[model samples]
Target: MPTESFDERFTGPTLNQDLWVDHYLPQWSEPARSRARYDFTTDGLRLRIDADQMPWRDADGSFRVSNLQTGTFSGAVGTTRGTHRHRLDGLLVETPQVTRRLWTPSSGELEVVVSASADPTCMLAIWLVGFEESGPEDSGELCVTELFGDRIGPLSSTVRVGIKAHHDPRLTDDVRDIELPIDATKPHAYGVRWSGDGVDFTVDGQVIMSSPQQLAYEQQLMIDLFEFPATEQREPRNYPKTAMVHSVAGTSAS
Candidate 1:
C-alpha cells in the first residue's frame, strides 16, 4: 500500500480575491479547504472555490449556482504536462471564469450545468479514470481508454462527450469501462446518480447512459473547463479532452 500524508495547516489563495478558497474542502481528509495554492497528494488534489463570486443558489431553487473561474489541477496532472510517474485516484472539477462557484452535494444527485457563451469553443467535461500502469515498449503508463474510449461530440452545436473501457494490454485480467457525457456549444446540464447497483448518467435533465462498474462511492467529484488557447486544428472546431475523475456520488433515479 502507498503511504499518504496531508498538511492540515496548509492554506492558500485563489487566483483572484473575489474567488477565495473554501477552507472546508470536503474532498481531502486533512487538507480539505485550500486558498489559491494547489498541489497533488495521492488520492486527492487541492483547489480554491469562491462562494461569493459565484452564482447564487438557495434551497428554494430561486438562483442558479455556477463555478466560474474557479480552477484546480485535479488528479495527477496540472494544466502543464509533466512526467507521468504517479498513479493518482479520484475526481477533479474546475472552471475558467471567476464568477461562478462549484457546488458539491452531500447526499443527493450530482449535476453539472454548462451555460453556452459566444465562444462556442468552451468545452466542459466530467470524466472518470480507474487506474494507470507502466506503459509498454517506449510508451509510459498504459491508459485503458485507448482501446474502448469513444467520443460523442457536440450535440446540435452544443456539446459532445464520450466513454471508454480499458483493457490492460499487458494484463488481460484487468478490464473496466466508463461512460461520460458532455456539452460544448449549447447550454446544457449533465448529472449522475450513484448507489449500490451502478451509476446513471443524465444530460439536460434526461438520463442517457448507465454503468454497473463505478467508483462513485470511494472517490471525490471533479469539474473542470478547458481554457487554453485553441490549436490550429481546434480553431474552428472544439476538440474535447478526456479526464479521469476518481470518485462519484449520489443515487440513481431508477
Candidate 2:
C-alpha cells in the first residue's frame, strides 16, 4: 500500500477553519465555557485545561474539556435520539443510539505529534470513535494512545492502547499498556494504520499495539486534553495540565 499524505498543522496564528470544528456536542453554543481552549502556537495547536476558568454553555461547573471532531454528527453527547425504553414482559430496556454522517477512511494511517500534559490531574487522548448512531453494532472505539500524568514514572510511562467493543460485535475490545523508551510528557508521534483486517499502532513509527478485528464504517478523529477537578474521591495537584500538538498527518494507499 502507498502512503496518502495528509497534513494538518496549527498555522497562521489560529486553527485552520477548513480542517476542524470547535466541538463534538451541539449544546455547547456560542460564548463557550470551561478551561479547554484551542489556539495556534509556534510549535502547533495549544490545547490548555485551565482549572480557574468558568463554565461556558451548560451549568455543569465542573472540569473543562475541549472535544473536537472531524465531523459534526449527533447534537448531544452520545445518542439521545429517542426514549428508547419500552416494557417487554414488564421489563424496561433502554436503547440509546443515533446516526452520524461522518468521514472515515477504510485503509489509512494517521499520526499525531503531541506533547502530553504534565499535570497529574490532566489527561490526553488520541483515538477514533465510531459514528455509532447507525446501529448498536456500530459502536466501537479505537484508542491509539491515552495517558494520564500520574501514570508517568521517573524513567517511562505506560501508554494505553486498544479497541473497545462498546456495542459492536466485530471487536474483542482488547487493550494494553505498553512501556516506552522516553517520557510521554515530551513530544512524540503516535500513529495507527488500518487495513480492513486489523490495526497496528505505532510510536515514532515503531509498532506498539495491534488488533485483528476491523471496523470499516464511518468514524472520526478525536484528540483532546482536559482536566478533572478535585472531588471526594480524587485529589488535586499543581501540574500545568495542557496538551501541545505539533502536527496531525495521515496517509492511505493510493
Candidate 3:
C-alpha cells in the first residue's frame, strides 16, 4: 500500500499558501481575472463563482470559474506555453508562471469529501493533471469527479470520470459519465487509486470504474467551481454558486 502523505481538513482562518494557488490558470488569463473566489470555513473550503466575476478569458464564451490548485507552471509571457491549452489556436501567456509543485504524486491513492450546489447553471470538479514542466506532451488529465448540476437528481447523479489525453501521445481520452445512486449536492467521498498498470475510481469506497492504461507522470490537483451564463434556451440562476470541499487525503508509493 502507498504511504500516507498528507491529509487536509482545511481547518483554518486562511488558505495555506504552501499547498494551494488560488487561481485557475493565471498564465493563460490575467491573474486578476483568473483569481479564485473562495474562503476557508470551519466546514472546509468553499469555492464560489459569483455573478459579477468575468469570464476566465474573454475569447471563451460565457463561462466563469473559481479554482484552486496544488501547482502551476508555464513558459515566459507572449509564448503559447501552458497547461490545458484548450484552444485549438493556442493561448499566449499573459503572465509568466514559475514552476511550483506542492503535492504532485506519481503513483498514489487520493480522496476527497466534497459537495456542490444543485443549481443547474453550475458545476464542480476535482481533477489531477500533469504539470508539464518537463515537456508539453506531458499534459494529460485524470478527472476524479466532475458533476454538472443539471445532471444531479434527488436520488442520484451522473458523474464524469476518466482520463483526458491533451498533448500526451501516450494517452487516449477515455472519459465517461456514470449514474450513481447518491445525491451529488450532499457531501460524498470520491477517490482514485492508481499505479503504472491501471487506475481505479471509487465513490464511497466502492469502485465504479477502472482503466487499464495509466499515466505515469506526476500530477497536481485542481479543484474548481464553474458557472455557465444563461443562453437563449437556458434561464439564468442566482449568483454565488458554490462547491464545498470537506477534506482531502492522499497516499503515495514514492
Whole-model Cα lDDT of every candidate shown, in order? 0.30, 0.64, 0.85
For residues 99-210, could you state the per-residue lDDT of candidate 1 as single tens digits? Answer: 1222221213555443333332223345432212222111121111111112224433322332233332322222233334443333355565555565556665676555
Q: Which is the better candidate, 1 or 3, if ranked by TM-score?
A: 3
Clashing pairs in 2: 4-251, 4-252, 32-56, 33-56, 98-133, 99-133
Q: Model 3 over residues 83-139: C-alpha lDDT tens digits? A: 677665757898899888788788899999999778888889989888777778888
Best by TM-score: 3
The runs of at least 3 residues in candidate 1 whose Cα sits more than 4 Å from the true structure, single-residue gaps closed, are: 1-108, 117-122, 127-155, 158-186, 228-254
Cα deviation of 252 in candidate 1 (Å)? Answer: 11
The lDDT of model 2 is 0.64
lDDT of 3: 0.85
TM values, all candidates:
0.35, 0.78, 0.93
Model 2 segments beyond 4 Å from truth?
Answer: 1-5, 27-36, 52-61, 75-79, 82-103, 232-240, 252-254
> Whose lDDT is greatest here?
3
lDDT per residue (tens digit) for residues 1-254 in model 2: 11235588777575554555555343233324522477677888878665454433334345566755554433343333311111113222122223333334546788999988756767788877665446546657778899887887657888999887766777786989888767887889998988777889999999997778887765567787766666523323543356888888876442
Better structure of 1 and 3 per lDDT: 3
TM-score of candidate 3 against the unseen true structure: 0.93
What's the candidate order when arranged by decreasing TM-score? Answer: 3, 2, 1
